[model samples]
Target: MNVFSALRAFRELLPVLRPEWRGMLWSYLIGTASALSLAGLTVLTAWAVGHAVVERTPPGPLWWVLVIGLVLVRAVLTWREMDVSHALAYRVLARLRMALFDAYARSVPGRRREHSGYAATVAMDDIEKLEFFYAHTVAQLGASLTLFLASLVSASVLLPEAGLVVLVGGLVVASSALYRARAARRLGEQEQRERSALSTRIVDALGALREVLAYGLAPRIIAETDAATARAAAIARRHELLSQLVTAIRELVITAVVIGIIAVSSSAAGVLAEGAQARLSPAELPALVALALAGVAAISDATATLTRLHPLVAGAERVATGIGRAPVVSVPERPRPLPTGPLGLRFRDVSFAYEGRRPTLTSWSVELAPGEHVGLVGPSGSGKSTVIALAARLWDPLAGTIELVTPDGTGIPVAELDDAALRDAVALVDQEAVLFHGTVRDNLLRGCAPRSDADLTAVLERVGAAAWIGLDDELGEGGVRLSGGQRARLCLARALVRRPRILLVDEVTASLDPATEQAICDVIAGFPGTVLVASHRAQTLARLDRLVDVTDITGVTGVVPAGRTGGA
Candidate 1:
């Protein structure tokens, strides 16, 4: 992106700082004071040295005291400024992370196509890269500019010619920030992309480590990762080289400005000409040169900060995009309350499709009576899971409405209901049972109200998991220690702990052994509220009250009936 585009991206992030304005102000003030004190110290020391050398006058005790005091004060302010700015930056980053997570929560699994690894990289690594922009850029630039302006004015009062030299040199140093701007930004973008790709690869490999090892692909994966790392390192080296080159140019400009100030002061003090009138005192020459150097240094510091921003532009843009992603479903402006009592589900003329894919459902219509147990059966890719997901409100239908129905046939569209209310009433247990790395109790209580150990144990016993798994049993990451049947049972227990009014199961029995499958089906059959199971397993379907063929449910005129017998 160009400079203007990068500026706009950063502008979008400014609102996050509204609450921290006081901290930002204090940081700027402290930084400016610290910078000015250093400049003052440099000029005072130069003036004292020149006075002693030119006029045989020793420095007073007050001069020494003033210098020592400035030293101590600058040191304290410098530390304080850093502390405040870094703290403010960490707070902003924390806020950004939460915002990004919310965005993901609302928008993700919509298309079900985003790479988990890449999304993780954007959330963690890319956001972390923005610390320099938040902590150093704004307040430090202001401090540098203030120091430069103060030094420039002092130099002009002492000698206009020296001020002119300082101004020219400062302009030169500032312009160096724009040197190779497009190239630096391009390199930065490339580096960020490479890093994200590497992160994705590593995450994918680790996630499928078993498969990688079984297929004997570990060597290939490692080789590819090494190559990616090398490419990323090369890009970083190039960026550093470019930054060093710019620094060299800035240092050269500062050096030339110092030389110009010395010449101007010498000529004005009649040190360069035999009979020239002294426009400046000999003792002031050193102070004038010091002032010019200080001004140039301030501008150089500001420019250096700007140059660093070119590389950070890519990460900033990524973070901004991630935060501003379009949610899969919009929250209602005035959400209606969920219907009272047991909640049944009805999909009325509902139609949906994944991104760039054929329609999964077309004008589909179906209903589950309150407290009824129904099974959805279809061939692979026949939209069984899609129906389950829609019932759970993972994504809104592209057309038509899915509603929560009361016993009286009053229907409230899911889209118009409050999100929390919908989530509270509906629970989903899909085929892929995910158990986080924590105690079984932690996973069970994830989104539910607090439950006593007795209550939790009762639920686990209902799912036939209490025999092997206790409430305090530690489930390694993703329940790696458990068998497939064991994981499925725990997942069921987790859902049962919520005691939801409606439970949606998607192929949860497709891969389980008959004993586990029968156990899970028994629990669903006994649920007091509405139950919708999408499965092709004969044993699972046979237990349901009726079965509906998902392939033929769409484009039906009225409430879809169980077109096929469960055992058929």
Candidate 2:
């Protein structure tokens, strides 16, 4: 990306960072002082050497005092700088992660066709990489430049010839940025793509490791992963080689500048062979060379720092793409209040499609009054789940509005409801419900803030799961070791505890035994509000008050998948 464009991406993260500006201020201040102190040490050492030589004296008490004091100051400043910057970086990372998660939740179920694995990488690793930029790279670069400028000014005061060389060398290094500017940006973009692809493959492989092993597909997956890794490696190698090539040129330029300064200064010292030149002493030569050498070395620092950030610039670009994504479902500026008492839902002529695919739902419509239980059935891909998604407002209809109607005839657009209110009004239980890594109670109350032990137990009983998931029981990741039926029951209990106004269940009993399926169906039937379930089993559909054929509403049709026959 261009510098302007790369910086623009950084701007997207400001909303999450704005609140922590106070901590950033402290970090920057400490870093600046540290950098300046280090720079000052070099100058002071050179000045001391010059005094010692010109005066024909070994040293003085003050010389040791100056060196010791500068070293101590540098140490203290460096420590403080690191301490403050990390404090800010960690805080920013935490906030960024939370914001990314919230964005995903708001855009999923309906908008889930987008790159989920890529987003996961952003929330996990890409955001973490930004710590270098947010914490050290940004502030350290600023401080280093400031110190370089100050050092240049001091050099000019002492020896104008040397100072000009330093100034010109700095400009040359800065101009070299133009050489690889376009290529670097392209490489950065390519690297970002490869990294995201690699991350996606890793996430997908791990998520489906069981199936991969069962089907003996490990070789194919391994080959694919290896290919992605090789591609990423190639991109990284090309990028690094280019950066190193530039750095080499930069070092050459600095060397040339240093040589030029030495020759010019030496000639000047010679001109003192007679009149004014005679006053210039040979004793000052080492000090002048030392100062020039130190100044030249700063060029290496500048070049190295820029090269280090080249990769991150690309990572930041990807993160910006994610953070900049416009959510498929938009929340209203002023959300309407939720319906009072039980909630009645209506979908009027809704239509939607995922990018290039044909319309998944075309001018579809449905209505469910409060306290009614409706089941959706049709062949696969007939948009059964889409209906439930619309009611939950996961995505807005392309052609119509999903509304919540009160008894008094008030129509509240689902989008107009507050997020918390919307969440409280709808609960979704899928066939493969995600159970997080935590205690049973933690997974049960993932986001419900006002949950109590009594409420938890009651919910468990409602789902016929009181026997398996005790408050302190360890369920492990994704509820490992739990029977399929137990897992379903826990998920069901989780949904039941929410007490939502509308419950959307997507084939929750597709793989369950008859007893477990009936038990789950009973729990859902007893729910006191609107319930919309999409299932292939005739038995499950028959349990509802009525069945709505997705084919009739979505203008698409299909035969039910054969696997669901056992449940019915």
Candidate 3:
């Protein structure tokens, strides 16, 4: 997208800030007042010099009083303008941050895989750059134009030739902003990409620091990061050089405008028609030049602002598209309550296909009765995990309905249930279940229903987790402070703390030893809840009430293991 369109998209992404608009208006007014005061000061100083040199008299007390009063007002308005604009910018940035977070929260683990650090850069760094656009660009541009117009009008009434010079100079400065803009946008986009890529690599390396050290890949990773940084810096250097060229062109145009004004005032051109009187007297020549410079300077500042904002269009488009992305699974406008009792999930002829992957299920139908402990079994890549995910409502099936049935046989579509209610009714503990950075108590609670320490302790003990860690004990990232088995147990305990009625487990025994897996199975066996576990291990499935071969559900002939039965 072009710069203007990108800017429009970014503006649309902002929360409706009626109050900020009002603040912007005030800021614009104060800023214009400040500019006019400075311009007026410049003109008055020139006029006073002229008066002293030509009229040979001390300046009157009124002129001094007016100058002093304007200086004080300018100082106050300058500070107030900065304060209001920056405060408004920060408030908008904060709102934008929240909006971005909410958007990601709704659409995350999105159909397309995006690096977490890249997303973080968009939400954090990209949004931060917009502060200058919001605070200094819009309101300041308006103030600049107002001052320019005021000066233009005043100068025109004094000397039409000088007014013409100001208009031409303004246009010239403004045109420089559009020059080579396509190149600027390309560089900006490349720079933005490299930065995000660098961030992603850094985050990935940090996340896998253990692996890096174990495999001795630190040097390679560091070298790659340095190369990425160098590429970004090279692009930035080119961008700076182009900007300098634009600045040089703009300065040349301003100098030409000044020289043109001086020539006209000195009658060197003598191009005016006969009987057309000069508007400016000889003594007022310098003041006229000063006024014209003020007007041109205002226009120059505006052009400079646009030039800087041009490089941010790529970042703007990203943040806007990210925030505007619709969630793949939409929430219900008016949710229907799930049935009251042990929750039983039913998938009715569901079909699902991941992006760029072959269809995993077609016309797949399955049923888990209330309090039924069912295991999903099949060969690897036979859609076992897919069934668990469908049950959890991570992404809605491309076709068909998944419902929760009550003990009394009432069926409520999972899609129609409120997000909170569905989460309360169901919990999943997959092999990848994560323990966030916090104390054990924080991990257990996680803003689920409030429970006392004794209650948390009891659930931990049930999951065989209480023996190791206390409620207040801290857990590092992903529970790296603990072993894999320990992490799994703590994760299971964390899920159990929610006391969900329907538990979905996906390959919870895939990597665990026989002892740890049996302990987890024992916890599942004793728990009086509807459980659906997906596993290939015969021993793990042997404990469940029955095993539903996923290959049979999908009608994939060779996908099922040899000698596998329909149900175990």
* lDDT winner: 1
Give the per-residue lDDT digits (tens) of candidate 2, residues 145-193.
Answer: 7666765776677678878888888788777776777787678678878
lDDT for 191 in candidate 1 is 85
- Per-candidate TM vs. native? 0.94, 0.89, 0.88
Which residue pairs of candidate 2 clash?
1-185, 272-277, 272-278
> What's the C-alpha lDDT at position 388 in model 2?
74
Q: Give me the displacement of residue 371 in model 3, in angstroms.
A: 1.8
Residue 185 error for model 2, in Å?
5.4
Q: lDDT of model 1 at residue 185?
A: 78
Q: How far in Å is the alpha carbon of 276 misplaced in model 2?
A: 3.9
1 or 3, which is superior by TM-score?
1
lDDT of 2: 0.75
Q: Write the per-residue lDDT of candidate 3 for residues 411-465, one digit (tens) a residue.
A: 7889899988899989989888888998999999985899999999999899888
Off by over 4 Å in 2: 1-16, 58-65, 109-112, 179-193, 227-231, 234-242, 267-274, 278-295, 553-568
Better of 1 and 2 by lDDT: 1
Give lDDT tens digits, candidate 1, residues 487-508: 8988999889998999999999
Could you tell me how far off, in angstroms, the CA of residue 438 lies in candidate 1 after the best superposition? 1.6
What ordering of candidates by lDDT runs from best to worst? 1, 3, 2
- Model 1 spans with C-alpha error above 4 angstroms: 109-112, 554-568
